[model samples]
Target: MRTSTTMPPLQALRAFEAVGRLLSFRRAGEELLITQSAVSHHIKQLEEMLGVRLFIRKAKSIELTPEGAAYLERTVEAFRIIAGATSEMRRQTARQRVRVSVLPSFAANWLVSRLADFMLKHPEIEVELEPTLRLEDFASDYADLAIRFGTGRWEGVRAEWLMNEEMSPVVSPALYDDGTRFAEPKELLLQTLLESWNPVGWELWLGEVGVDIRRARVLQLTDYNIVLQAALNGQGVAIGRMHMVRDHLAAGRLLQPFPQIVRSEKIAYWLVMPQNRRLRPGAEAFASWLKEEAASPPSPVC
Candidate 1:
């Protein structure tokens, strides 16, 4: 006789669950990838453990007894809960795949440029980039990780400081080759100030340079990419986030107008992940690689 504290074997529980559902030990064996004898053994053991006749056996069929019906109901419900939890965990840790939620501007200007190298190095792992302005809730069934640009005050997530933000003015070299020229900080008033939807704005930068924020003429653009495009085309001088424009600056597509650079007071880049859930193996690999990439100096523009 089994004690109240003692639980039946897992094999017996599985066999009972299947046999009670299908009403046939033979059919249950087939579903469980075992022989009919093994299924019978498990059922006999399970019935003896509980000291109850769980099934009524006929010559050609079997049916659950009243006691078995009640037990099976509870067993099936327990199985359902177990299966659901297992599925949710597996979905997050899907094999060899890492999904990331990031801002469109960062994805296009920063990540896209360096993604190819990661792919070449880790062909076995796959990375999916989901670009959106919305912040990710890692507890949800969405991205495995997130790249956030902020002061890292978000709740219920772990934020690793990724990089610092540098602010400076960038313009096309053509802008100065006889077109629009700014000799000093005060001369920028003569040019159309290209602005973007960013945490740090031209007004803040202007104030730092001793220029009256109200006196600055601004042309608002939709996003940072557009702002850079307008500056590259000599449309106006745009504030450059150094990490985003490093490649462009190195390639001579854009040039910094001033020697002074200011680090943002309240914002920078961070790698975010769930505080409670463990990262998938693939996500762990990607995260380690990403940290290494962030720590190392960036490659020179070719």
Candidate 2:
């Protein structure tokens, strides 16, 4: 018997597949959560290992070479088969835990409160939630489903509209009492704006109400939680994702000074799953329950 050393690393294969499909190193890196230089290195390593040039790199673009095209088909099929097997195994298990990947902001602000109803209803299905900004690769046997915030146009994936999104400015009651009032759009320009992961928010809100201030002060925070916390601490007024701030506003913890709200046209929360794949036993139940839970809360977007 002889042992063979002919298998390529999974990272290299994934990089190759992403690049081959997208035809751009930068886009592939964005999808795979690697640097463009790293993707280039992986392709270079893979090409060296196989002793063949995989991409015909040009000054502005890249195209898969003959061998690369051939290899891409096999790589894609291999990932698909592995994903199918994993899905099948999950379905076979009677109580496979429901693993859901979600954005941290949405998890903290919206889902966590409603999730108890789901657990209570479906006691047999245990659930694990992974919160991160990185998009889950469904072919890697990780998450059964994911709640993604986007325009519902992920490549090679199935996305269903979960909720609409709106933006507004929110502040603490103490900030209001301290005389930093957003009575008009001009006042917003005068004060420091709190921005979470989305930096374009203040600009977008300002543009929506036709208040252009080139040098509005912004306090940037890494996550929505921090941004909201800072706003609660009277640090600054945050451009609130309405879904996240609605409860706070209702509870009088946060104040919405102005009435104007912008309904985001480009993006919303979407329930995303692997394209052409069935959910696992637990995931199937969880997915159904999630939709039911999400059905009525968000007011209709006009």
Prediction RMSDs, each to the true structure = 7.4, 19.8
Total backbone collisions for each predicted model:
0, 0
How accurate locally is residue 102 in candidate 1, as Cα lDDT from 0 to 100?
A: 87
Q: Candidate 1 regions off by >4 Å?
A: 1-94, 199-204, 300-302
Ten contiguous residues with the weakest lDDT in model 2: 293-302
lDDT of 1 by residue, 94-121 (tens): 5477899987778988888788888888
Q: What's the TM-score of each model vs. the native?
A: 0.67, 0.65
Pairs of colliding residues, candidate 2: none
User: Candidate 1 clashing pairs?
Assistant: none
Q: Cα deviation of 267 in candidate 1 (Å)?
A: 3.8
lDDT of 1 at 85: 99
| Model 2 TM-score, 2 decimals | 0.65
lDDT of 2 by residue, 1-302 (tens): 45236987779999999999999999999999989999999999899889999999999999989999999999999999999999988667656588899989889999999889988888878899999877777888789999987678878889888877778889999987886655578878777899866666777788888888476888888888899999999888899888888888888889888888887745478899989889976898888888887777664323
